[model samples]
Target: MVNTSFALSSTTRRRLSLVIGAYTVVVFATIVALGVLSATASDHAPRDAWVHAIIVAVFAILLPMRLRAASRGSLAGLRAIGIISGVLFMVNVVESTLSMFPVWMRTEMIVIALLMLVSIGLVVRERL
Candidate 1:
Protein backbone atom coordinates (compact mmCIF):
# COMPACT_ATOMS: atom_id res chain seq x y z
CA MET A 1 0.00 0.00 0.00
CA VAL A 2 1.49 3.28 -1.07
CA ASN A 3 0.47 6.33 0.88
CA THR A 4 0.90 9.64 -0.88
CA SER A 5 -0.70 11.81 1.74
CA PHE A 6 1.69 14.11 3.58
CA ALA A 7 -0.78 16.20 5.50
CA LEU A 8 -0.12 16.10 9.23
CA SER A 9 -3.03 16.33 11.62
CA SER A 10 -3.40 19.48 13.64
CA THR A 11 -2.76 17.54 16.82
CA THR A 12 0.40 16.03 15.40
CA ARG A 13 1.59 19.40 14.19
CA ARG A 14 0.98 20.94 17.58
CA ARG A 15 2.78 18.11 19.30
CA LEU A 16 5.68 18.42 16.94
CA SER A 17 6.02 22.11 17.57
CA LEU A 18 5.86 21.60 21.32
CA VAL A 19 8.53 18.94 21.20
CA ILE A 20 10.83 21.06 19.05
CA GLY A 21 10.12 24.13 21.15
CA ALA A 22 11.07 22.28 24.30
CA TYR A 23 14.23 20.98 22.69
CA THR A 24 15.18 24.48 21.58
CA VAL A 25 14.57 25.88 25.04
CA VAL A 26 16.64 23.17 26.61
CA VAL A 27 19.48 23.68 24.16
CA PHE A 28 19.53 27.40 24.85
CA ALA A 29 19.42 26.81 28.59
CA THR A 30 22.30 24.35 28.41
CA ILE A 31 24.46 26.79 26.50
CA VAL A 32 23.70 29.54 28.98
CA ALA A 33 24.45 27.20 31.83
CA LEU A 34 27.68 26.17 30.19
CA GLY A 35 28.70 29.79 29.86
CA VAL A 36 28.12 30.37 33.55
CA LEU A 37 29.95 27.21 34.50
CA SER A 38 32.83 27.95 32.19
CA ALA A 39 33.10 31.41 33.61
CA THR A 40 33.73 29.87 36.98
CA ALA A 41 35.98 27.02 35.87
CA SER A 42 39.14 26.76 33.81
CA ASP A 43 38.50 23.21 32.60
CA HIS A 44 36.04 23.96 29.83
CA ALA A 45 37.43 23.87 26.31
CA PRO A 46 36.81 26.80 23.96
CA ARG A 47 36.18 24.47 21.06
CA ASP A 48 33.41 22.64 22.89
CA ALA A 49 31.79 25.96 23.78
CA TRP A 50 31.86 27.05 20.17
CA VAL A 51 30.33 23.78 19.04
CA HIS A 52 27.44 24.20 21.44
CA ALA A 53 26.99 27.82 20.39
CA ILE A 54 26.64 26.74 16.78
CA ILE A 55 24.13 24.04 17.65
CA VAL A 56 22.01 26.54 19.53
CA ALA A 57 22.12 28.97 16.62
CA VAL A 58 21.03 26.35 14.14
CA PHE A 59 18.12 25.25 16.28
CA ALA A 60 17.07 28.87 16.79
CA ILE A 61 16.72 29.40 13.06
CA LEU A 62 15.24 26.05 12.15
CA LEU A 63 12.60 25.89 14.84
CA PRO A 64 10.49 28.75 13.59
CA MET A 65 10.95 28.17 9.87
CA ARG A 66 10.29 24.47 10.05
CA LEU A 67 7.20 24.91 12.19
CA ARG A 68 5.80 27.50 9.84
CA ALA A 69 6.47 25.37 6.81
CA ALA A 70 4.96 22.28 8.39
CA SER A 71 1.84 24.23 9.30
CA ARG A 72 1.52 25.21 5.69
CA GLY A 73 1.70 21.54 4.56
CA SER A 74 5.14 21.78 3.07
CA LEU A 75 6.54 18.31 2.46
CA ALA A 76 10.01 19.67 2.04
CA GLY A 77 9.83 21.18 5.49
CA LEU A 78 8.72 17.88 6.96
CA ARG A 79 11.46 16.02 5.16
CA ALA A 80 14.07 18.49 6.29
CA ILE A 81 12.87 18.23 9.85
CA GLY A 82 13.09 14.47 9.75
CA ILE A 83 16.60 14.45 8.31
CA ILE A 84 17.83 17.16 10.64
CA SER A 85 16.33 15.40 13.65
CA GLY A 86 17.96 12.11 12.73
CA VAL A 87 21.37 13.74 12.24
CA LEU A 88 21.13 15.73 15.44
CA PHE A 89 20.00 12.65 17.31
CA MET A 90 23.26 10.95 16.39
CA VAL A 91 25.25 14.05 17.28
CA ASN A 92 23.61 14.29 20.68
CA VAL A 93 24.16 10.64 21.40
CA VAL A 94 27.86 10.98 20.59
CA GLU A 95 28.11 14.15 22.66
CA SER A 96 26.44 12.49 25.62
CA THR A 97 29.19 9.88 25.69
CA LEU A 98 32.08 12.32 25.54
CA SER A 99 34.19 12.62 28.73
CA MET A 100 35.07 16.30 28.73
CA PHE A 101 31.63 17.79 29.34
CA PRO A 102 30.14 17.93 32.81
CA VAL A 103 27.80 15.05 33.69
CA TRP A 104 24.83 17.40 33.82
CA MET A 105 25.53 18.65 30.33
CA ARG A 106 25.94 15.12 29.06
CA THR A 107 22.60 14.25 30.62
CA GLU A 108 21.11 17.19 28.83
CA MET A 109 22.39 15.81 25.54
CA ILE A 110 20.46 12.65 26.22
CA VAL A 111 17.33 14.69 26.79
CA ILE A 112 17.82 16.52 23.55
CA ALA A 113 18.43 13.27 21.74
CA LEU A 114 15.17 11.86 23.03
CA LEU A 115 13.36 14.91 21.73
CA MET A 116 14.99 14.40 18.36
CA LEU A 117 13.88 10.81 18.37
CA VAL A 118 10.33 11.91 18.96
CA SER A 119 10.61 14.40 16.15
CA ILE A 120 11.89 11.75 13.77
CA GLY A 121 9.02 9.48 14.62
CA LEU A 122 6.45 12.23 14.16
CA VAL A 123 7.65 13.19 10.70
CA VAL A 124 8.05 9.61 9.58
CA ARG A 125 4.54 8.74 10.65
CA GLU A 126 3.17 11.72 8.80
CA ARG A 127 5.06 11.03 5.62
CA LEU A 128 4.19 7.37 5.54
Candidate 2:
Protein backbone atom coordinates (compact mmCIF):
# COMPACT_ATOMS: atom_id res chain seq x y z
CA MET A 1 0.00 0.00 0.00
CA VAL A 2 2.81 2.40 0.90
CA ASN A 3 4.65 1.58 -2.29
CA THR A 4 1.52 2.16 -4.33
CA SER A 5 0.97 5.54 -2.67
CA PHE A 6 4.53 6.59 -3.36
CA ALA A 7 4.26 5.55 -6.98
CA LEU A 8 1.07 7.49 -7.42
CA SER A 9 2.58 10.60 -5.89
CA SER A 10 5.61 10.33 -8.12
CA THR A 11 3.45 9.98 -11.21
CA THR A 12 1.44 13.04 -10.29
CA ARG A 13 4.61 15.06 -9.81
CA ARG A 14 5.95 14.01 -13.18
CA ARG A 15 2.72 14.89 -14.90
CA LEU A 16 2.67 18.31 -13.27
CA SER A 17 6.25 18.92 -14.31
CA LEU A 18 5.46 17.97 -17.91
CA VAL A 19 2.50 20.32 -18.04
CA ILE A 20 4.59 23.19 -16.69
CA GLY A 21 7.40 22.47 -19.12
CA ALA A 22 5.07 22.42 -22.08
CA TYR A 23 3.41 25.63 -21.03
CA THR A 24 6.76 27.37 -20.64
CA VAL A 25 7.92 26.31 -24.06
CA VAL A 26 4.74 27.47 -25.77
CA VAL A 27 4.78 30.84 -24.00
CA PHE A 28 8.43 31.43 -24.79
CA ALA A 29 7.96 30.62 -28.45
CA THR A 30 4.98 32.92 -28.75
CA ILE A 31 6.83 35.78 -27.09
CA VAL A 32 9.87 35.34 -29.31
CA ALA A 33 7.74 35.32 -32.43
CA LEU A 34 5.95 38.47 -31.36
CA GLY A 35 9.22 40.17 -30.49
CA VAL A 36 10.67 39.38 -33.87
CA LEU A 37 7.56 40.60 -35.63
CA SER A 38 7.58 43.84 -33.69
CA ALA A 39 11.28 44.49 -34.12
CA THR A 40 11.19 44.08 -37.85
CA ALA A 41 8.31 46.44 -38.48
CA SER A 42 9.11 49.75 -40.22
CA ASP A 43 6.01 51.85 -39.58
CA HIS A 44 5.14 51.23 -35.96
CA ALA A 45 4.34 54.12 -33.67
CA PRO A 46 6.95 54.74 -30.99
CA ARG A 47 4.51 54.13 -28.15
CA ASP A 48 3.22 50.95 -29.68
CA ALA A 49 6.70 49.64 -30.32
CA TRP A 50 7.73 50.36 -26.75
CA VAL A 51 4.67 48.63 -25.40
CA HIS A 52 5.24 45.58 -27.56
CA ALA A 53 8.84 45.33 -26.50
CA ILE A 54 7.95 45.63 -22.83
CA ILE A 55 5.26 42.97 -23.01
CA VAL A 56 7.52 40.56 -24.82
CA ALA A 57 10.28 41.16 -22.31
CA VAL A 58 7.92 40.50 -19.42
CA PHE A 59 6.77 37.24 -20.94
CA ALA A 60 10.33 36.17 -21.62
CA ILE A 61 11.25 36.76 -18.02
CA LEU A 62 8.13 35.30 -16.45
CA LEU A 63 7.70 32.08 -18.40
CA PRO A 64 10.45 30.27 -16.59
CA MET A 65 9.41 31.62 -13.21
CA ARG A 66 5.85 30.55 -13.85
CA LEU A 67 6.94 27.06 -14.75
CA ARG A 68 8.95 26.82 -11.58
CA ALA A 69 6.02 27.98 -9.52
CA ALA A 70 3.71 25.50 -11.20
CA SER A 71 6.18 22.69 -10.59
CA ARG A 72 6.19 23.55 -6.93
CA GLY A 73 2.37 23.44 -6.80
CA SER A 74 2.20 27.16 -6.07
CA LEU A 75 -0.81 28.44 -7.97
CA ALA A 76 -0.83 31.86 -6.31
CA GLY A 77 2.30 33.09 -8.00
CA LEU A 78 1.11 31.91 -11.38
CA ARG A 79 -2.28 33.48 -10.86
CA ALA A 80 -0.74 36.81 -9.98
CA ILE A 81 1.40 36.80 -13.08
CA GLY A 82 -1.54 35.74 -15.21
CA ILE A 83 -3.73 38.53 -13.93
CA ILE A 84 -1.08 41.17 -14.58
CA SER A 85 -0.27 39.82 -18.01
CA GLY A 86 -3.94 39.62 -18.94
CA VAL A 87 -4.58 43.20 -17.88
CA LEU A 88 -1.59 44.53 -19.78
CA PHE A 89 -2.57 42.48 -22.80
CA MET A 90 -6.06 43.87 -22.81
CA VAL A 91 -4.74 47.38 -22.49
CA ASN A 92 -2.40 46.85 -25.40
CA VAL A 93 -5.22 45.51 -27.52
CA VAL A 94 -7.36 48.52 -26.83
CA GLU A 95 -4.55 50.95 -27.48
CA SER A 96 -3.46 49.32 -30.68
CA THR A 97 -6.96 49.12 -32.03
CA LEU A 98 -7.93 52.70 -31.30
CA SER A 99 -4.61 54.38 -31.87
CA MET A 100 -3.06 54.84 -35.30
CA PHE A 101 -0.68 51.92 -34.81
CA PRO A 102 1.03 50.04 -37.61
CA VAL A 103 -0.04 46.58 -38.73
CA TRP A 104 2.85 44.94 -36.98
CA MET A 105 2.02 46.65 -33.70
CA ARG A 106 -1.58 45.54 -33.96
CA THR A 107 -0.53 41.99 -34.67
CA GLU A 108 1.87 42.02 -31.77
CA MET A 109 -0.89 43.25 -29.47
CA ILE A 110 -3.14 40.42 -30.57
CA VAL A 111 -0.41 37.89 -30.00
CA ILE A 112 0.25 39.16 -26.50
CA ALA A 113 -3.44 39.01 -25.69
CA LEU A 114 -3.61 35.43 -26.86
CA LEU A 115 -0.58 34.51 -24.84
CA MET A 116 -2.06 36.04 -21.71
CA LEU A 117 -5.31 34.21 -22.27
CA VAL A 118 -3.43 30.95 -22.59
CA SER A 119 -1.62 31.59 -19.34
CA ILE A 120 -4.86 32.39 -17.58
CA GLY A 121 -6.44 29.22 -18.87
CA LEU A 122 -3.52 27.10 -17.78
CA VAL A 123 -3.51 28.58 -14.30
CA VAL A 124 -7.26 28.09 -13.93
CA ARG A 125 -7.04 24.54 -15.20
CA GLU A 126 -4.36 23.77 -12.69
CA ARG A 127 -6.52 25.09 -9.88
CA LEU A 128 -9.47 23.01 -10.95
Candidate 3:
Protein backbone atom coordinates (compact mmCIF):
# COMPACT_ATOMS: atom_id res chain seq x y z
CA MET A 1 0.00 0.00 0.00
CA VAL A 2 1.36 3.38 -0.99
CA ASN A 3 0.47 5.68 1.85
CA THR A 4 -0.09 8.92 -0.01
CA SER A 5 -1.15 11.04 2.92
CA PHE A 6 0.76 14.26 3.32
CA ALA A 7 1.34 16.63 6.18
CA LEU A 8 2.06 20.33 6.30
CA SER A 9 5.77 20.94 6.04
CA SER A 10 7.52 22.41 9.05
CA THR A 11 8.09 25.71 7.27
CA THR A 12 4.44 25.91 6.31
CA ARG A 13 3.38 25.09 9.84
CA ARG A 14 5.59 27.77 11.28
CA ARG A 15 4.34 30.35 8.80
CA LEU A 16 0.75 29.44 9.48
CA SER A 17 1.40 29.65 13.19
CA LEU A 18 2.72 33.17 12.77
CA VAL A 19 -0.26 34.26 10.72
CA ILE A 20 -2.70 32.70 13.16
CA GLY A 21 -0.95 34.35 16.07
CA ALA A 22 -1.19 37.68 14.35
CA TYR A 23 -4.87 37.10 13.77
CA THR A 24 -5.29 36.31 17.44
CA VAL A 25 -3.60 39.56 18.35
CA VAL A 26 -5.90 41.49 16.08
CA VAL A 27 -8.93 39.84 17.64
CA PHE A 28 -7.76 40.65 21.13
CA ALA A 29 -7.17 44.22 20.08
CA THR A 30 -10.74 44.48 18.87
CA ILE A 31 -11.96 43.25 22.22
CA VAL A 32 -9.97 45.91 24.00
CA ALA A 33 -11.15 48.56 21.62
CA LEU A 34 -14.76 47.60 22.18
CA GLY A 35 -14.33 47.84 25.93
CA VAL A 36 -12.70 51.24 25.72
CA LEU A 37 -15.30 52.55 23.33
CA SER A 38 -18.03 51.28 25.57
CA ALA A 39 -16.89 53.38 28.52
CA THR A 40 -17.75 56.64 26.83
CA ALA A 41 -21.24 55.84 25.67
CA SER A 42 -23.81 55.76 28.51
CA ASP A 43 -24.72 54.05 31.78
CA HIS A 44 -25.73 50.72 30.34
CA ALA A 45 -23.66 51.07 27.22
CA PRO A 46 -20.36 50.26 28.86
CA ARG A 47 -21.81 47.35 30.71
CA ASP A 48 -23.29 45.82 27.60
CA ALA A 49 -20.29 46.41 25.42
CA TRP A 50 -17.82 45.29 28.04
CA VAL A 51 -19.68 42.08 28.73
CA HIS A 52 -20.00 41.40 25.04
CA ALA A 53 -16.35 42.21 24.52
CA ILE A 54 -15.10 39.91 27.24
CA ILE A 55 -17.06 36.88 26.08
CA VAL A 56 -15.94 37.57 22.55
CA ALA A 57 -12.37 37.74 23.77
CA VAL A 58 -12.80 34.35 25.32
CA PHE A 59 -14.14 32.98 22.04
CA ALA A 60 -11.47 34.74 20.07
CA ILE A 61 -8.70 33.18 22.13
CA LEU A 62 -10.02 29.63 22.17
CA LEU A 63 -11.68 28.86 18.86
CA PRO A 64 -8.86 29.60 16.43
CA MET A 65 -6.23 27.68 18.36
CA ARG A 66 -8.63 24.86 18.89
CA LEU A 67 -9.46 24.69 15.23
CA ARG A 68 -5.79 24.72 14.33
CA ALA A 69 -5.09 21.86 16.67
CA ALA A 70 -8.07 19.95 15.33
CA SER A 71 -6.83 20.22 11.77
CA ARG A 72 -3.72 18.36 12.84
CA GLY A 73 -5.74 15.37 14.04
CA SER A 74 -6.02 16.25 17.69
CA LEU A 75 -9.41 16.16 19.31
CA ALA A 76 -8.19 17.36 22.70
CA GLY A 77 -8.11 21.06 21.98
CA LEU A 78 -11.29 20.98 19.97
CA ARG A 79 -13.21 19.33 22.78
CA ALA A 80 -11.92 21.87 25.25
CA ILE A 81 -12.87 24.95 23.26
CA GLY A 82 -15.82 23.82 21.19
CA ILE A 83 -18.45 23.72 23.89
CA ILE A 84 -17.30 26.83 25.68
CA SER A 85 -16.88 28.90 22.56
CA GLY A 86 -20.24 27.81 21.25
CA VAL A 87 -21.93 28.68 24.52
CA LEU A 88 -20.18 32.02 24.77
CA PHE A 89 -21.02 32.90 21.20
CA MET A 90 -24.67 32.01 21.69
CA VAL A 91 -24.87 33.87 24.98
CA ASN A 92 -23.20 36.88 23.48
CA VAL A 93 -25.64 36.83 20.61
CA VAL A 94 -28.67 36.56 22.86
CA GLU A 95 -27.41 39.19 25.29
CA SER A 96 -26.43 41.51 22.53
CA THR A 97 -29.79 41.05 20.89
CA LEU A 98 -31.51 42.09 24.11
CA SER A 99 -29.16 44.93 24.93
CA MET A 100 -29.34 48.55 23.89
CA PHE A 101 -27.35 48.13 20.72
CA PRO A 102 -29.05 48.76 17.40
CA VAL A 103 -30.67 45.90 15.57
CA TRP A 104 -27.94 45.87 12.95
CA MET A 105 -25.16 45.11 15.41
CA ARG A 106 -27.25 42.36 16.97
CA THR A 107 -27.81 40.88 13.54
CA GLU A 108 -24.11 41.04 12.81
CA MET A 109 -23.36 39.17 16.00
CA ILE A 110 -25.79 36.42 15.06
CA VAL A 111 -24.04 36.04 11.76
CA ILE A 112 -20.66 35.84 13.46
CA ALA A 113 -21.93 33.28 15.93
CA LEU A 114 -23.34 31.16 13.13
CA LEU A 115 -20.03 31.26 11.34
CA MET A 116 -18.33 30.05 14.48
CA LEU A 117 -20.71 27.14 14.62
CA VAL A 118 -19.83 26.27 11.05
CA SER A 119 -16.15 26.25 11.96
CA ILE A 120 -16.90 23.97 14.85
CA GLY A 121 -18.65 21.60 12.51
CA LEU A 122 -15.69 21.57 10.17
CA VAL A 123 -13.33 20.82 13.04
CA VAL A 124 -15.47 17.93 14.16
CA ARG A 125 -15.68 16.50 10.69
CA GLU A 126 -11.99 16.89 10.01
CA ARG A 127 -10.26 15.91 13.24
CA LEU A 128 -12.69 13.89 15.26
Candidate 4:
Protein backbone atom coordinates (compact mmCIF):
# COMPACT_ATOMS: atom_id res chain seq x y z
CA MET A 1 0.00 0.00 0.00
CA VAL A 2 1.19 3.49 -0.77
CA ASN A 3 1.89 5.70 2.21
CA THR A 4 -0.11 8.90 1.97
CA SER A 5 0.99 10.24 5.32
CA PHE A 6 2.73 13.35 4.12
CA ALA A 7 1.96 16.29 6.36
CA LEU A 8 2.61 19.99 6.00
CA SER A 9 3.31 22.59 8.64
CA SER A 10 0.41 24.81 9.58
CA THR A 11 2.08 27.86 8.15
CA THR A 12 2.83 26.09 4.92
CA ARG A 13 -0.73 24.86 4.65
CA ARG A 14 -2.07 28.35 5.21
CA ARG A 15 0.23 29.79 2.63
CA LEU A 16 -0.73 27.15 0.15
CA SER A 17 -4.38 27.83 0.76
CA LEU A 18 -3.85 31.51 0.14
CA VAL A 19 -2.12 30.82 -3.15
CA ILE A 20 -4.73 28.33 -4.26
CA GLY A 21 -7.61 30.61 -3.27
CA ALA A 22 -6.14 33.51 -5.16
CA TYR A 23 -5.65 31.39 -8.25
CA THR A 24 -9.17 30.01 -8.07
CA VAL A 25 -10.73 33.44 -7.69
CA VAL A 26 -8.79 34.87 -10.57
CA VAL A 27 -9.62 31.96 -12.85
CA PHE A 28 -13.32 31.98 -12.01
CA ALA A 29 -13.60 35.72 -12.41
CA THR A 30 -11.89 35.56 -15.74
CA ILE A 31 -14.26 32.89 -16.97
CA VAL A 32 -17.30 34.89 -15.90
CA ALA A 33 -15.97 38.04 -17.49
CA LEU A 34 -15.20 36.25 -20.70
CA GLY A 35 -18.61 34.65 -20.75
CA VAL A 36 -20.33 37.98 -20.26
CA LEU A 37 -18.19 39.71 -22.85
CA SER A 38 -18.72 36.95 -25.36
CA ALA A 39 -22.45 37.03 -24.80
CA THR A 40 -22.47 40.75 -25.42
CA ALA A 41 -20.17 40.76 -28.44
CA SER A 42 -21.62 37.82 -30.30
CA ASP A 43 -25.05 36.41 -30.84
CA HIS A 44 -25.70 33.95 -28.02
CA ALA A 45 -25.16 30.60 -29.63
CA PRO A 46 -25.73 27.30 -27.89
CA ARG A 47 -22.20 26.25 -28.70
CA ASP A 48 -20.61 29.39 -27.30
CA ALA A 49 -22.55 29.13 -24.07
CA TRP A 50 -21.76 25.48 -23.86
CA VAL A 51 -18.07 26.15 -24.21
CA HIS A 52 -18.22 28.74 -21.47
CA ALA A 53 -20.20 26.36 -19.30
CA ILE A 54 -17.61 23.68 -19.77
CA ILE A 55 -14.82 26.02 -18.79
CA VAL A 56 -16.74 27.05 -15.73
CA ALA A 57 -17.40 23.42 -14.84
CA VAL A 58 -13.74 22.57 -15.16
CA PHE A 59 -12.78 25.50 -12.95
CA ALA A 60 -15.35 24.45 -10.39
CA ILE A 61 -14.07 20.92 -10.17
CA LEU A 62 -10.36 21.61 -10.39
CA LEU A 63 -10.24 24.41 -7.85
CA PRO A 64 -11.66 22.25 -5.07
CA MET A 65 -9.51 19.31 -5.97
CA ARG A 66 -6.43 21.50 -5.89
CA LEU A 67 -7.26 22.76 -2.45
CA ARG A 68 -7.97 19.30 -1.14
CA ALA A 69 -4.80 17.89 -2.61
CA ALA A 70 -2.69 20.65 -1.15
CA SER A 71 -4.25 20.28 2.27
CA ARG A 72 -3.62 16.57 2.22
CA GLY A 73 0.08 17.14 1.49
CA SER A 74 -0.18 15.59 -1.92
CA LEU A 75 2.60 17.71 -3.31
CA ALA A 76 3.15 15.49 -6.31
CA GLY A 77 -0.49 15.53 -7.21
CA LEU A 78 -0.74 19.30 -6.72
CA ARG A 79 2.32 19.94 -8.81
CA ALA A 80 1.06 17.72 -11.61
CA ILE A 81 -2.31 19.39 -11.65
CA GLY A 82 -0.73 22.81 -11.45
CA ILE A 83 1.55 22.14 -14.39
CA ILE A 84 -1.31 20.87 -16.53
CA SER A 85 -3.60 23.74 -15.56
CA GLY A 86 -0.89 26.28 -16.17
CA VAL A 87 -0.09 24.94 -19.61
CA LEU A 88 -3.74 24.79 -20.59
CA PHE A 89 -4.24 28.34 -19.31
CA MET A 90 -1.29 29.60 -21.26
CA VAL A 91 -2.60 27.91 -24.38
CA ASN A 92 -5.99 29.49 -23.82
CA VAL A 93 -4.37 32.90 -23.62
CA VAL A 94 -2.36 32.32 -26.77
CA GLU A 95 -5.41 31.12 -28.64
CA SER A 96 -7.50 34.03 -27.42
CA THR A 97 -4.86 36.56 -28.38
CA LEU A 98 -4.47 35.03 -31.82
CA SER A 99 -8.22 34.79 -32.30
CA MET A 100 -8.68 38.52 -31.58
CA PHE A 101 -10.20 38.20 -28.16
CA PRO A 102 -10.12 41.28 -25.94
CA VAL A 103 -6.91 42.39 -24.25
CA TRP A 104 -8.52 41.88 -20.85
CA MET A 105 -7.81 38.19 -21.23
CA ARG A 106 -4.20 38.95 -20.47
CA THR A 107 -5.07 39.59 -16.84
CA GLU A 108 -6.16 36.02 -16.34
CA MET A 109 -3.18 34.79 -18.28
CA ILE A 110 -0.85 36.66 -15.95
CA VAL A 111 -2.56 35.20 -12.93
CA ILE A 112 -2.11 31.73 -14.31
CA ALA A 113 1.52 32.40 -14.98
CA LEU A 114 2.02 33.58 -11.43
CA LEU A 115 0.24 30.54 -10.09
CA MET A 116 2.41 28.31 -12.19
CA LEU A 117 5.55 29.94 -10.87
CA VAL A 118 4.34 29.70 -7.29
CA SER A 119 3.44 26.07 -7.70
CA ILE A 120 6.88 25.33 -9.06
CA GLY A 121 8.38 27.18 -6.14
CA LEU A 122 6.28 25.21 -3.72
CA VAL A 123 7.35 21.95 -5.24
CA VAL A 124 10.97 22.93 -4.95
CA ARG A 125 10.63 24.28 -1.44
CA GLU A 126 8.94 21.14 -0.22
CA ARG A 127 11.82 19.09 -1.51
CA LEU A 128 14.31 20.77 0.84
Alpha carbon lDDT of each predicted model: 0.78, 0.56, 0.55, 0.59
- Model 3, span 1-128: residue lDDT tens: 85333343454345434534553565566565565556764443355555665656666677567656745745465465557546755765676557576454466466556655654454344434
Instruction: Report the Cα RMSD per candidate.
Output: 3.0, 6.9, 6.2, 3.9
lDDT of 1 at 12: 79
Off by over 4 Å in 2: 1-42, 45-47
Question: What's each prediction's TM-score?
Answer: 0.86, 0.57, 0.56, 0.65
Best by TM-score: 1
Q: How close to the true structure is residue 123 of candidate 2, measured as C-alpha lDDT?
A: 55
In model 4, where is the ten-residue run with the lowest total lDDT?
44-53
Pick the winner on TM-score between candidates 1 and 2.
1
lDDT of 4 by residue, 46-75 (tens): 344346435644764675576577667776
**Range of the 10 consecutive residues with the lowest summed lDDT in candidate 2:** 1-10
Give the winner by lDDT: 1 or 4: 1
For model 4, which pairs clash? none
lDDT of 2: 0.56
Instruction: Give the lowest summed-lDDT range of ten residues in model 3.
Output: 3-12
- Looking at model 4, residue 42 earns an lDDT score of 48
